[model samples]
Target: MEQHVQKQPDSPVPFFLWRHLNTVRRLVLLLVFCLLILLPYISLYQNFVAGHAYDLLTPHERRIYDVMEWLTAPIARSDPANNLNMIKGNTWSGTLFGLKLSDPLAVVGQVAAQFKLYWPFLLTALLPVGLTLLLGRFYCGWICPATLLYEINDAVRHRLVRLGILAQGRRMDLRLKYGVLAVGVGLSTALGTVVFSAIYPPLIVGREIQYWVTANGVGAGTTFFLLTLLFDLLVARRGFCRYLCPGGALYALLGRYRLVRIQRLVNRCNDCTLCDKVCPFALRPMRDAFGQECNNCTACMAVCPPRALTFRLRIQDQPDQGPGHQGPAHRRAAVRVTAKGEVA
Candidate 1:
């Protein structure tokens, strides 16, 4: 949406920047998911090449082998097996040009379970941790593969609400996820295993996509992920990410003092409340109350007609900015003060 707040002198929002961030975030989400899907086929092709199994393959398998070979022709012209291995692994942990990168939650989980830090693994998470510290739980919004599915599922929830098949949204304490995170860590420590990979939606999505695509049969997390979809559809809106995700809890904590945060340009706000309505996490962007729970998803900014929302460099959210200047409520209050010399 085009912003009309370009004339506001004190507006913090730069009319030129981040206006389309929501769209860019959506594209990045899809790209990450597409890579997850594509990687499995690449793995299969690498295996096929290693085994020299083209003649032994059935018709369907041969077709997959052929398609993958064609896709990787430029990259793997000389050494299909070695070259195609360059971009391996999923979002949980991956390598590109020998630079390993991983989710900070994964590093935390592994260390907690083993009670020892693998320096190599720990190093892999630095980039993500540093980024989260600066961006505030942006991984949930920008990179998580499961977030892509969760949002699409959220769209379905909206349709169901419109059809009266489901109620609007069920509210709960946002602190619930912190408890889940503590419990998850406790269990991992006690069990001496990284248990979150089984329950966390992002890792589960990556695992299941690799499994199902490679014909390894559906992983057990498939049922659990499906149940989460059901829960989001029937019980609460975006329930898993909103309340139960341990990874989200970890990210939120790490990003609690994040430097970049979305805020309302109160002067430009008309209190349309569209920002509040569109937030997946049920945050009230118009009220200037985005806390640690915000992922900087930019969905609020996209729906705002007056373009009252924008990212700002701040460690904490602004306190309630009250009614928007352009809104009728503020106008009525101004009228009352003008007539009676006191706020009504």
Candidate 2:
């Protein structure tokens, strides 16, 4: 809660790999997105393998069976059911290598819906909650399939803005997501359903990917997701995630005092505003204003030409550090100070 430095501290050199984390993060996002698409097909294959019904299947079914058989031949040939059971479900709630992990918001939404606790189900979310406590909304940055699409949408937004097809994305109050979370919780309580699973972009994206992959006609979620893309394109850049996601609100609350956060290195910063420009969460890393909303996506760090940003083990962001030492304002100030000294 109390974060301040009376004077700028000397720099601690960041490791070379710190900047590469965004690339690693993109790879992780793609891997997770692929897994979301792959797991459904795997489940479909598992059903056929478990039934031993290859001969009974239709031509299309047999082709799926053939491809899945070849794909899973290495590890799951013996017992696709048991062997492939190592991974199941989507990001909302999934078992991986015998460990079940779930979205924290999933648990919250369920509790609101059922009005009773299922301890076994609740336990599944602990790993993610624990990670969020330390990592501060890392799920949004590193794992959420929706985020990958949102960023692509953001890129498209930039293009459209340049072409005068759209204006710069409108900035709304960040607190709006908290209101969304409250309303969603209330609605779940009243409706007795985990309503967020339908609206939450990550869950929606995974569900849609599965449908399209499994050759099930895409669901209503596709239409909703497409609207979100348009919302980001026309209304705001990442409008839903920034202003309306309940899951994001929950993570922001949980990770309010996240132990590991990105800190600005005043010495290296040139106040060029690149970090501010690239931040997905719209955090002001250039002004040391990274708050709970920062997902530690490191797009800011990656875009830092001076390599000014780095991660630190701290509970809060440093107070504003003023203009970077390399900036024009600081240079002008320095010149004025030197002249005053000579005059004195």
Candidate 3:
């Protein structure tokens, strides 16, 4: 006799939206990376034309250059001195909707340089830090160009693992990144410069890409960025981001009181461990719901077969319901889980 099987219901709209959002998020990151590479070349070409290279340009090239310059004008700085040295006409800093987008670490270094805190630097730092308070390390997961490279390396590693050519790498202590941050801050304070920028992967990659695009050669930081890629590929998956990224450590600290978090339905979880396996940061969403280490990537939510996970906004003092409850009834669950995976 033939047996009949029951099919499970489809996931809720939020889950479906989350799956598509992940794809959109990746596309956005790729677009940002491409823009970073292209902006420098555009600036270089415009500068060359302004310096009499215009006579050598084809009509079509001239039109393209004019259009690009106009398009990038709002975000691009006009003063050469204000731009990044490598990308002379391309600005490293800009305002987005009147909000400053400068690096907080750079701001800290500036304050250390003067041996006094400046209100302007503090105000500039607040823009990114305030966003982090709402989004929770979203920059690491959604925008950082180095994260794009890390994700590529991670994908390659996963393929190798499936083909029996690589092993599942061990997860390092999350505190290592904090320790690295402390050391970097100490060095920057002592040296009175942005010491972290010299080796920071994102900044290195940006400078290198700008150099390559404009000068047709790699920059001083290229070697450091490439070494970071190698470390991610062979030494440990996401080694730089997880344990050595001072910038990430700063974000984690800034995002400590993030309003949004990943919520888990304990009753739905069957302990399949798929969510844990898919997390690039090695976050165990099933066992440690809403952990601060979570970058809010939602990869776990997308991979969860039972639709047990979803992003939610909750107060810091909310109770943690161990694994089974769902919704408003579970609002007062036990204490929330800390970054160390301990019940707080």
Candidate 4:
């Protein structure tokens, strides 16, 4: 069977800077994630964690009862209210849903304690809220450690499938996210814990490295690198993102309500289907762009030959009129008018 491919467009896009910066930022974040995983054992960043934790919690969570009693200084006289101002006993089972997970390492090793020390709880709390408003789940697309892991895993799976070691499926079977969504919601509502956080890639990698570093040394760091490499180099699609992330599932719901989207002008479309092929999320960009599943990746816009498709920031929903709805006669008449204007 013969296949047709569209030629590249002549002019460049202005948003290439935005796209390039996004790509570079993601790459750097991925590297930081790697370093964070290794730092527990190498003790490069662990001291920072320890110093922060000790400075903040020394009088409360960690100081011995006698030491606390013996200290005559006014600073040593810790008020229960001061120690607990951050956490209210009125624990709503569901207020902070999808915000954070309860990982053993985060909870047990006192690193979680340190995280709160380095950054104010309110500041961290505001990130998802503010980001959700401006960029609409930008954290999920770029910074979330879990998404990065999934992207790497998916890339590996793609190569393996190409090599015939794995079979490819047309349907993404994305219903898995719904299941994870349910479990996360249920656990958070019922148990007052973000159950999904235990398996969340960030916490998983963080905790695993913490344990490994405490037990092994540089060898453990090597193991962590190899595991990350295997996931990225072997998995075809964003396996973890597609199959496991509850946070992603939550943000997808937010995307449904998000106003901004990558829209295609159907009248100008040349039927090249470049957008459909380049979409990483496996969304049919032409048919189902505004259907809440598309991640606004803009791969279609990057490849569009005539710049036919544009990222329209629309205020109202437009009807899904099918492709090239007008007849050839109407198009020819329009083209003649356009040609006459050009000649004049």
Candidate 4: lDDT over CA atoms?
A: 0.49
Question: Which pairs clash (backbone N, Cα, C closer than 3 Å) in model 3?
Answer: 266-323, 319-333, 319-334, 320-333, 320-334, 320-335, 321-334
Cα displacement (angstroms), candidate 3, residue 147, comes to 0.5
Query: On residues 282-322, what C-alpha lDDT tens digit does candidate 1 reach at each position?
Result: 98887798899899999888888877887789999999989
**C-alpha lDDT score of every prediction, in listed order:** 0.87, 0.87, 0.70, 0.49
Query: RMSD of each candidate?
Result: 4.1, 5.0, 8.6, 11.7
For 71-105, candidate 3 gives per-residue lDDT tens digits of: 66665567432342333321224454455566776
Give lDDT: candidate 3, residue 84.
Answer: 25
For model 2, which pairs clash? none
29-87, model 4: which lDDT tens digit per residue? 58656654533423422232335544454343343322333432243244422321222
Question: Lowest-scoring 10 consecutive residues by lDDT in candidate 1?
Answer: 1-10
Q: Return whichever of 3 and 4 wins on TM-score.
A: 3
**Compared with the true structure, what per-residue lDDT tens digits does model 2 show for residues 1-344?**
22222224367668789889999999999999888877888898999888988889999889888887898889896888878888887898888999999999999999999999999999999999999999998998999999999988899889889999899888999999999999999999999999898889999988787777676778989898889899888877788888888999999999999999998888877789988888877778878998999998988878888788888999988999888877767666666656666421
lDDT sort, best first: 1, 2, 3, 4
Indicate the residue-level lDDT of 100 in model 2.
Answer: 90
Candidate 2 accuracy as TM-score: 0.92
